[model samples]
Target chain A: MKRLKPSLVFIFLVMPCSLLVAFTYYPAIKSLFSSFWNQGTSRRPSKFVGLENYQTLLADDVLAQILWNNALYALVTIPISIGLSIGMALLVNSKIKGTSLMRLSFFLPTMLPMIAVANIWLFFYAPGIGLISQIMQYFGFEPINFLGDASTSLWSMIVVAIWKESGLFMIFYLAALQAVPANLKEAAKIEGASGIQVFFDVVLPLLKPTTIFVAVNALINSFRLIDHVIVMTEGGPNNSSALLLYYIYEVTFAYRDFAYGSALTVFLVALLGLMALFQFKILDKKAHYQ
Target chain B: MKSTINRIAYSTLAISLATVWGFPFIYSLWAAFHEEKYSANFTWNAPLTLENFATVWAAAPFSLYFTNTVILTLIILASNLILCTLVAYAFARYKFPGAGLLFSFIMVQLLITPDILIVENYNTLAKIGLIDTIFGITLPYLTSAFGIFLLRQTFKTVPISLDEAAQVEGANTWRVLWDVYVPLAKPTYLAYALVSISFQWNNFLWPLIVTNSPEVRPITVGLSIFATVESGVEWALVNAATLLSTAPLVILFLIFQRRFVANFMRAGIK
Candidate 1:
């Protein structure tokens, strides 16, 4: 009976995971395999064309541009988002009245669905009477084409992304900040550490683990920058803001090229895998206190 | 005197920053409550009206979408809580073979999220004839590595003596789990539940890809149609529609604001 009970529990636990493998991991592997094949139609048999999809992807100028845009988007957004989040966290974590309300306000954007947020932000980016353009005009500057022109489109998307994500990351940093021993800060203060000095010398060092955690989370989210692209740009303005996931989505759905989309997926998965490996390695290190 | 100045400066900076962060939301609420045509105007002087909310509510099957979203989120949450707890218990307590390997495999799912695997996941759904269904949307999220890892960490903190005593009193593993571990891990469960619900509720991409028609489309997806490319450039109406779609969650967050923040903090800590 004892043996039977343990086995039942094991089976119950393992069943869902097995389903995960069959449904998720199986498709993941199949996707990688399918990338090498020309799965042309629903009825016709797919031909095995080894590395052809990859070769095609490499030589394709649009694909290259899309990849570059995605990389640039990640580079610009991740650091800015993390930096703003840290700043927000510091402010909200301070001994100020109405700190809770401030924190809540900051996080409000993140709580809304991305599509909803995008819709509102899109309105703000509108030309004639848009909030941003009106503000620019108020400041005696011409209304800059935020999401319209190719030159400014990707950066505009990055700005919107930073706005949405920084607050969410701030919550993580705030939680980590709360865990910091209050005595440490007090001791630093007694030692005549200036506010900035205390922040850099004491608080920043203590938040290293949090920095890593936030950075990794931001990295993963950076790759998942498809929804905003879909809702706002749709990879428009001459494919300037086309991110990887969005590019893959376009290839699969819009362009109807499943094999190439699968190839992009494989590449994206590989990048994410590398990121996960790096994150795990960093997390494995003993968290430094001093 | 210097400290007082510093405090005031920090407070000013914080409030301004909060305002900048929150202004769009205010704009959204205003737009949602204003006339549909007035949604385009960026003025703060627009008269407030609930007519836009009525239009958004009556335009399509938003109630159905909300019900679907709630149902899908709940199912995913319930399944995650149960399966993750069980798996976490095994990892926490048992000396089973291949346990480490199994746990690591589960962790891999975190790296390869639904957004990344949407294409293959869609194909998988098509193969299993679960396309355009709520089950399709929920299946990929059913076994979350974050939930498993969190519950495992929480379960490990429970005292072993409690489990042993329960076992000695003729209580089975399930009984012990229910009687001791579940009660002890309530906070963790609450934390995980909040995270899970928020994630599933705000989730857009997977649901967008899996479910085809309005019948199975979640609110997020339904909200997307209103913001579609063909829609007229009515910013106010779009923002109004957006606000209406997200109102339930916003209200819930406001009501349980403290608990929600605490839950997020707890989840992050773990």
Candidate 2:
């Protein structure tokens, strides 16, 4: 292979690298820099306040609530969605009748925009005359407001996240499941393992890497994806369903508080950086097998 | 007898789960097709009408939103393809100083996406006078780290012999890439394109932050605005609008159902 000239390589790299620097790296560094400052208005010019924003972040009650809400959201949604996806993958991969139809039903939600999904689910969680309410009425029960009530709003968001995400993860699991050596399962069966035992013992362990992959993706998504909260509840009923990103959105865009928003963004970047660390560690391990 | 019973039970479980998974979309369809009165009232004889759809289409600039979304998605997709291809080829074939460090910087973007950097990005766009335009909406996403990564992996897999063989025929670098590398990475391109389209099409927050005009708003942001009116609830009209926004991708998924699944799998496992 011929070595390309340095100038040509520079030309090739300039556009994308410049854009990446302009958008991703520059914004990141700016956020970190601005987090040390305080928000300023025309009446009061901006002031340098080192560690003040972070100090306020430590004391901010709303930030605490938002962090707690996000943690719970991730904790609940990640495990349930992972479990459901594995089940869905196994189901679709099985020799079941109407598997194609089943797969379509499972995966179609993954194709829709999160905003559209939020819209459809908004109706389902509506106080009365909604589907769930109508079903509750049929069963001789009073309708409960899902998104309106603070207690259930976060949980409702969790359900939507699970529904929207599990199908996509199921595709990953399906790919992994298909790649699971057939002879391993056969050998397990030959050792008198039952179907459940074979799955638990042989298949599930092999899925550990996929599980970690999905978990990291889910963690990032739980931080990044707050469209449903914006659409359905708008983090309302006292900010019950507010995740970290939604809070940042509210602080930056809605409230027009840039410094605090920058602080929040820095915090979020740090949190996601941890997840990135975990992923690279796993990727390093996976690379050895290759 | 036990095996038969188990099969029946398993099928029932699978079918029931599918129903639960599909119920929300199915309900939206039902609401879209029915009158407002019949939206929540499931009846065997309820008349289906396109009236809600008509109202929805006339109510908002949905057609314009749809056009903007398509344009935005295509611009980003094309830009990602061309720019990432150039960058990925360099990374895959060339050994430049600081290449490893630069690649790691790109990988940082996979987790801390532009979505999370909204405030600063919005500030930057405002300073550049690109806010509220479709171009502003398309600017940050014109290239993506994942696309670069995927294409680089694909380009690296093309045998060096093929590059040498093409070069021996007096093919230039661009020609070698265009003819030899690009064609061979068709699957990667398709996978990247599909993933990029769906992502940019569905991207809401940044566009919502950047573009406030109907002419520039993508369907997701438009749909959010249309649905969030604090007035009396009109399930039929709202759902009609929802379906309208999602109809294109839904139809595409239906037509290329298997391909969508395969591409998603390929992209995800990467």
Candidate 3:
């Protein structure tokens, strides 16, 4: 019985995590292995064509375009979402009336599922009768193809992502904002510091850690921005808005090219790993202002 | 005078931003209730009705979708809570070999989200013959690395004296964990629970890939059916379906509005 207790603990802890590792890590490593091969649609054994897949990926114009699209998507959405979230955090953190209600209203969209929210926006983006088009028409402009035009489709998706995520980010900033020392702001005020100056010198510096946190999170989210794309665009209108992950989905599921999909997945996992490492190393170094 | 102008500017910016953020939602609520043929035209003159809601409810088996989602989310939640707490306790308290490696391995899971792994994961599920099953849908997320990390941080804050006291009273390690550590980590548990529930509740892609039929589809997947070409771009019905799909989480947010915000803040992921 005495020996059984520790063994039970070992089993309890190790077993569940092993299941997780089997489902998560095993496939991850398998994906790495599968990336080197050409296992498209046959029941044949995967014969790895060493680095050929990588060479092909480099030369693939579609892959290159998707990567460019993803980079642009990340660049545009991350900054806007973080900026808007900080703005929201500041607004709700103010000693204003109805602050709680404002917070709730802002954060409410984050609660809705992305698919559901995308559906609403999909209708809003519908051609002539959509809300934005109607508004545009009212303002003496021709109706624009928001989702149909490749130029605006990605941006439209970004708008939805920003709307969904900014409020959640605001909550984090608000928490960090509350942790800022009240006396420091008062001291800055007494030293003839304007509100903008105080914010720039004291508040912004104090909020740096939270900024790093938000930035890393936003970067991760930007990479994971496939849900809405799948629902709304499906990387459509001539693959103009084809983010990397959605492209991967198309390669594997829609096209039934497992090996190529695995190659794309490898690139994505490596990209995410680099992002996580960069976030931890760079952000954590700058995060320790205290 | 400049300060007054700044205040007005900030307030104006804040209000306008809030409206921009809040308007689509209000529009959705309006569209959900009203039976307007064309949703693109905005007018405040339309009378609201519940007919669209009734139509959406009858058009699809949203009740089954809700049940599947609830059951799947609960399964993931219960498993994550138990497994995460145990693993976190081990990491926090034990001096075992490879503990750091294992914990870092868990952290790697965060980097490879389900979206990145969807293709290979789908293949894996197909191999195991678990595709189209609720267990398959919920299994991958049943053990959360974020939950483990969060709880480990919370557990480390617990004083060693409590464990020693429990030991002196002849209680086992499990008993110490349950009676001492768990109680002390209630807020952390609650925070983790809320986060886990929210993630699973709103999860789309995995369920989309795993389940093939309406019987196993969750609310998100079921609602997506309305957006497909067969549904023919009926904006009012789509909004109605979406509102119904999101009703549970929205209702929960409304009820525990304060705690929801507090829990999110405490979770601290910006």
Candidate 4:
């Protein structure tokens, strides 16, 4: 064991600890405590109205709609992106000509800023002048307002999320696919297994950890990444596309309702905490060394 | 014959999907270069012109935004490198009290990133008189938990023998870390640096909340404000500005495609 020196420890720990405490730990704890109080200003400093903020949270109709929107976003985006990423990995991993070009195209979106991507897609979803609408007009279909309609607004947001996300996740799946043992597939083939059979029975099971990793990370991402929403929809057409984090942003900044915003933040944190719990329990169970 | 047909079908599907994936960016490139009438026109023979770029350049303070982004990104990257290196060295080499607990606290940050605490962080920055300043934007990101974690894992992989050898050769702790650990973790440093640069450069929400003016706004916030507030501006001009904002990174990506992809893959595995 290395000898521990007091000065060395102090020198190293000072900056990291202070910053983490100031930004992450303190604010997180403060938000939890602040959730129990009512909003106040200098004239009448805040009062501890126990559970009142949470009570308001319970009755919040916008919160209900936001949660439903986020849930649908997570459920739909997660699985489809995962499946698409797997397919993308398989395509690139194959010996197809122009695989390098395909790989470049697949990963290009991962490099661009999500805000820029939103701006680019915004043109595509613009009413009659948009690309999709122009094509629809050529085919004689009526031009649909993709982002303006309440019914299709969230789905449009989902399409952008899937497009931006699946590319990055494809890299993860590609790495995992490359690590699958070649001889194992050969052995399976020797046992009369078809390519699809070998993949489902052999290769895919080995990729479970990667899938779980991508899934949990994608779930955390679903809540945090609302840049597109801000740029494209602003959770508009009557809060039809508002997400949990976006709602917290609006409540805290747009409305200046700190108490209620604190409650909403706590709810978001708890949802993330649930994801953490799922990650640990599930990852622990699934991690087995051969 | 059956296998040839299968191969042709799969290749066609792959190429078509790639086109869809690449279409938005390609369209942005097309619109940014051509006239407005051809944004969705798909005219192969349309005369290309730099008029939109000229208009966009005159419209916004994109040059200043570009400079601010460079300054902000460099400062954050430098600070993260220094601070995380020191902290990671300590965690990797020292046997100290509460080290495990402290390390776990840092790990907690990987999930509860500074991004999610935007409201509270804004309040904190405001109370401390950092709001509307570039320093305020830089403060929350100065020491990345992921950076420390990645470097710690990398430093730990540096065989203890090399560390001991460096110390025995009259190297001080700083010298030992610089000469032994840091050199050995060069790839991790490069990977972390690239990831951090892209992330800080592209970061929007927190910076958007903190910065209120053109003097301190990064490229992303500037682009967002430009795109949203200038609703009446033609798509061609907006797309031109968008392309301008993303040009540096995109150019670097095209030039260093292999290294960028490899580093991203390396970062992802951890």
Candidate 5:
């Protein structure tokens, strides 16, 4: 009993806590603090210039465009992917043969690295010698530069994002759809419910929990999975296709400006933190395992 | 008659959607194997060759990249598995003070992941003099919230009776964790490992941000550099490199897909 008491909890907990603190919490708090200061020079350390970074965030035009693009990205990709995932899941979840092969096709994109997928799609969107142009030429139409053009660049990357993420989301929907139980549907049919009616009446309610979970996952991914922007356009054609996180990368790494980057990161952290709080509110009692 | 029609319609829609999803992979295979001239066009008679793989191998130090990836991935996996297991056991079984707050802090990582803190993390790495090292690439990811959450869920499911049986036999805490909890959580381990390994193996932005030299670049980063437009894009060679970087996970998926999907379901993670 003595050996199993709370004294030994320190042994189990210390390492993981140190790691979490060092990596996640420390950087997060540091970024919050540093976002207020200017970057240090050789002789002088950083000095606090309160709200100046936030003011810059408001005044930054390219940053606004990038945030809008991210919002557009979320708007376009989330619902489309969720719809496609539920469809794909239902298709594979049915009592039919050859679903394994179909399941493979859907999830294959989910397997390949995001950067690799970006590379593949880069060829598809490349002008003149690329596949899309070749197809347009076969139809005697002039080729449009997809990624190089400002208007089309964001949408092209959005399409690639849809292709990459929908398949992965399908797996979750498939798991949930499979657990829906056949007898419920059979009972509905016996009660003279049509397929579509049975779907809305019976299936949708059951899928609500799953839909909420998938929505949250999809939302986070919209922010995290912006690697395509790095490979495809580098937020090019004059920052037309930039996203928030990728913009942070550009500011921090490419421009070597950590203070401003920290400000932008605070915005991202706040956005995600709001999302986590929302999930917590809805999931308070349901959250499992202490 | 209507039911039959509905079935056919659904089947057609499903098959076509799958084909649309499959087009890129099919194109990769065809474009990789065929001669460059016909790589863009689909034809039955295009002659195939292994030259692209050779060209790709020659162009980059993928061998070094592969070595770096293996080292970094193994280090992360070993560390995560051990650390997550210990913490998860504590969260599931113990009655420590500040446990709730600590668990919430860890769970907050799901939202504010290491990848999101790249700039500050770079500063952290620079301060510690680990920037550009392989260790730096993995420093922020050594302990994963998803792994801890997953293992904790798995451990809570473990019958308390088995643990007590081991305890009554005079097994110490670590021994009970090893002899009782760890063995029972094999499926969860495999699921978390697969996710961690595959994700870290293919992770680009962090490694790209942290590692400057080719010495510590992983295959995904290597692929990005190898396929840069400055080199005058050759479809065959680029596709070959993509396929090479992607093949291990693809092959593993093909073989253990059942285990993969099963573990995800059993572990209660999507």
Candidate 6:
């Protein structure tokens, strides 16, 4: 009967987690182990080189640039995306005309595949014949090669990231806005708080938990969402637009450098781990707020 | 009087912002309907044609890609539903040793994702001889952390009294779970399933790396490679292909936006 109980427990839990072991748990452990070794191909076994890959990654200029680009992507995309989300949510939440239309239009981008959207954006950012260039020509401004220039390429990707994230994140905020008690708002108004003051004093604090959730999503997406990079620029213009995940793709797949790619993956795992802790703190604050 | 003017200005600004958001798909739709020569510019008199879609269909094996995607999505959704329900039941009903640590470890996948482990996963898949197959593309995503989390939350809300009543009726643990928890969480399953379908349908990157042949490649990878290989000269065909891939989901969204919103809320995603 004791044996039967243990087996039942295993069947209940371990059997299910075992399915993920092949892809998630095992690969994570392997990535950790492989980062310490140099493995060239599937035929040969990896050699344990003791942090040689780490030294190479530290000195790698392209890795440094990719890291910077990712930080910039997160830094610029997070706040703007969150702000736009809140603003859009508030707009739709209001009893404005065509609110449903506006909400659907904003949310449409979330449904489209990033790869296909990147293809359309390619036309919008191309030189001369592109949509942006046509708009520029009408204003007598010089046509800019948005995707081809080293300076603007990264920014163009950032625009896509912002556009993609803002609409989806808006939905989360909209849900929270809808849940806020109408009586509370009316009470604040009765107390003579202006719209802005009421928003800051009542609505904002109520939306704090949702804000934390959306912020964490956007932060992680900024790091991992490199599909548009593959479609639009392929991290070109001298690697100016290369985010860390894209660099990991290029290194591991195109260059067949597994050790260094695993090193990059380790950095990504670390960043996400830090995010987990940050999220815990934020969540703890929410608990305290209650 | 000043307030009237301010209201008008706000309305105009909001409308323009909405227009900016919708402009890309609008352009794609216009180009998809027009002849290639007239598609390059806004010409009201341009002859509309269904020929671009036909051209796009013959230009790629999109039907095959569609089949592959559907099969891949089905396999993933089915496996996820079964596995996540069981695991979430264990999480909600049982108090096993080290279960807290295990749950936290599983939560790490919520942030890290198997995409980050692409390098090692590819190596592992190759060792198992699953490369270049639909199974290879779908394997990494089959066990979703989000699914388990969502279902666990739902299962916890199942009244424990009902579970105990079922146990008193001689139902075993498995029977209790199947009869009580699973039946109660059907709406949660529906909600989570839709979210999963929409995401896995449009998923790229890892699929692109794993599947090379036309037989196994999903539409996103297929469409992405088509754009790069054919270049920008055939915008009409490209737009038509894009429309083909996205139209179903957009229509689904339009019809079910309320359900989508409500389901997301019920999931308590935060």
Q: How high is the TM-score of chain A in each model?
A: 0.92, 0.95, 0.93, 0.96, 0.93, 0.93
* Candidate 3 Cα deviation (angstroms), residue B200: 1.0
Cα deviation in Å at residue A120, candidate 2? Answer: 0.8
Model 2 TM-score is: 0.97
What is candidate 5's lDDT per residue for B37-107, written digit by digit as tens? 87777779888899888888888898998999999999999999999998888888877667789898888
DockQ of each: 0.58, 0.71, 0.57, 0.65, 0.66, 0.57
Q: What share of the true interface contacts does candidate 5 keep?
A: 0.69
Structure candidate 1, residue pairs in collision: B39-B236
Can you write out model 4's per-residue Cα lDDT over A143-248, one digit (the tens) per residue?
A: 9999999999999999999988898899888888988989999999999998889989999999998888789779989999888889998999899988999999
- As for DockQ, the candidate ahead, 2 or 5, is 2
TM-score, one value per model: 0.95, 0.97, 0.95, 0.97, 0.96, 0.95
> Of 2 and 6, which scores higher on lDDT?
2
User: Where is model 2 more than 4 Å wrong at Cα?
Assistant: A282-284, A287-290, B230-232, B263-270
- Which of the predicted structures, 3 or 5, would earn the higher lDDT when compared with the native? 5
Standalone chain B TM-score for every prediction:
0.92, 0.95, 0.94, 0.95, 0.97, 0.94
Q: Report the C-alpha lDDT of model 3 over B73-187, residue by residue, as the tens digit.
A: 9999999989988888888887765667878888787767665688778988999899999999987888888888788887887888888889899999789889999998887
For candidate 5, write residues A1-290 as lDDT tens digits: 12336576666788677988998999999999999998777898889999999999999999989989999989999899989999999899886668999999999998999988998988888798888898999899999999999999999988998898888888887877778889999999999999999999999788777777778888998888778899989999999988899999999888878999999999999999888888888764443334
Query: Candidate 3 chain B: worst 10 consecutive residues by lDDT?
Result: B261-270
- Residues B135-170 of candidate 2 have per-residue lDDT tens digits of 999988887999888888878889999999998999
Docking class of 2: medium
Which segments of candidate 4 are over 4 A away from where they belong?
A41-43, A287-290, B264-270
lDDT of each candidate versus the true structure: 0.81, 0.88, 0.82, 0.87, 0.87, 0.84
**Model 1: how far is B102 from its true place, Å?**
1.7
Interface RMSD of each: 3.1, 1.8, 3.6, 2.0, 2.2, 3.4
- lDDT, residue B214, model 6: 83
Poorly placed runs, candidate 5 (over 4 Å): A1-7, A43-45, A282-290, B229-231
The model with the greater DockQ, 2 or 3, is 2
